[model samples]
Target: MARNFAHGNYSHTQKKARNTGRTARDQTRRTLSQNFMVDRHAVDLMVKAAAPEGLVLEPGSGEGALTLALAEAGARVVGYEIDPRLAGQLAARTRNDPRIDVIRGDFTAARAPREPFAVVGNIPYSVTSKIVDWCLRAPDLTSATLLTQREYARKRAGDYGRWSLVTVESWPWFSWRLGDTIGRESFRPVPSVDSAILLLRRRPEPLIRGRRSYQELVELGFGGVGGSVRASLRTRYQGVDAALAAAGVPRDAVVGYVHPDQWITLWERLCG
Candidate 1:
């Protein structure tokens, strides 16, 4: 025979159990950084921004949401998911679809396809920089459309009017743009920050020759040695003042304020 507990006590115990369960679920999601996109409109917007055709690579393909959408848009998708349960589910769900290939592995470790391809995904925020680095290094990559933290998208796209070192370095090969913003509410187990689409499309021809020297020049300019970009660049290159003037860079401008195009012009004037 079991003794009955007081109603208030029973209610309190139940509430604590529920709270614990909820906290565990939230913790798991956070640990994985897997805030999956649940809004149909957001998915459509991401697909549209990618305009994915031919072969496409998707990172963190949670539950096959964006993967199926990419296939629907006529893309041959190779989706990488690290979570075994989610990977198995996605693979089983898309087994009949010839357009989709689900791979259970770390996308960062995957090799780039020989043929040209576009990468599109609602990637895990924890590995956003790593994934972007992989996309940048892919020789045959044509474009990448990613749903990243709004702050990251803005920074990479130079939406804040200040350019990052990575963006400045990669500007010759890739054009970065900030696309649609997806509200935090659009995700299941909504993330603390909203997400935005970041589009990187490779140029048909690089903006400058001698990639190594151009990167070195950019590195020198960004060194911040003497305060201003003009000053920092002066430490290495001759005629930096003339180059700055030709590039339309202000004498007191910091490297972040200088545009990528201006950097190219500076390279042409100083090194070309």
Candidate 2:
């Protein structure tokens, strides 16, 4: 027998012979955290951003909602899901598409595809930042559209606030935007919180080089220290003064807000 979880409430089915009245292991909601996207409009927006071009990868392909959409858009879509049941269903759903491939595995641990690809998915909120970092480190990733927590979406887009690490790190390689929010009611088992979609596009080349210059600078700005990496140059250069001066940053501008490439100019001049 199947139990039901709806409107944020968990309800078990009638008890039968030897039935403990709990949902089956596969049917029981996993504690993956905040699986809250039931809106078609939100799905449409993510697909639109991806544009269904070339090869596309979707991590956390829950229930195949967005996966079907991407396949319909004519993209060669590969979806990875950690849940075996979900993966099996998704695989069946898109098996005939030929362009779609479904993998059952942990996306965070999964190796990136050899070919260049774009990524799309409604990511698990708990590990959103780690996924973002994975996207950044992927050498051949072209772009990504992820449905994440609204707060994280804002931070990633740097919407009218100080740049978070994601914003600073991905600025040169990818641009980000916070799209619409999906309400709590949309999900089968409604989550306590809502979600927002974030779109990211990868850069063509390295924005700044010096081994780990941008990474180190970002660490410093955020008050993290490993090798004097956390010391803010903001006070020393009066903003980006130290970085700018060291990089021979020609103009009287700050390196912090400058494009990653321009910041590279400073790094090359100063650190090299």
Number of the top TM-score candidate: 1
Give the per-residue lDDT of model 2 (tens digit) for 1-272. Answer: 10111122223322222435635542334445537357788788778767868888888788888888898898887787766666677777776678778887667776777888888988888789878888888988888888887888876676644356557655656778788777666665676777777888776775554547655655554453222321344433334455555545444333234444444554454455
Return the TM-score for each candidate structure. 0.91, 0.74
Per-residue error for 105 in candidate 1, Å, reads 0.7
* Overall local distance difference test of candidate 2: 0.66
Which residue pairs show backbone clashes in model 2? Answer: 173-203, 237-241, 246-270, 247-270
User: Per-residue lDDT tens digits of candidate 1, residues 102-203?
Assistant: 887778888899999999999999999999999999999999999999999999999999999999999999999999999999999788999999999999
Any runs in candidate 2 off by more than 4 Å, and if so which? Answer: 1-28, 34-36, 224-231, 234-269
Q: How many backbone clashes does candidate 2 have?
A: 4
lDDT of 2 at 28: 39
Per-residue lDDT of 245 in model 2: 53
- With a 3 Å backbone cut-off (N, CA, C), the pairs that clash in candidate 1 are none
lDDT of 1 at 259: 97
Candidate-wise lDDT, in order: 0.87, 0.66
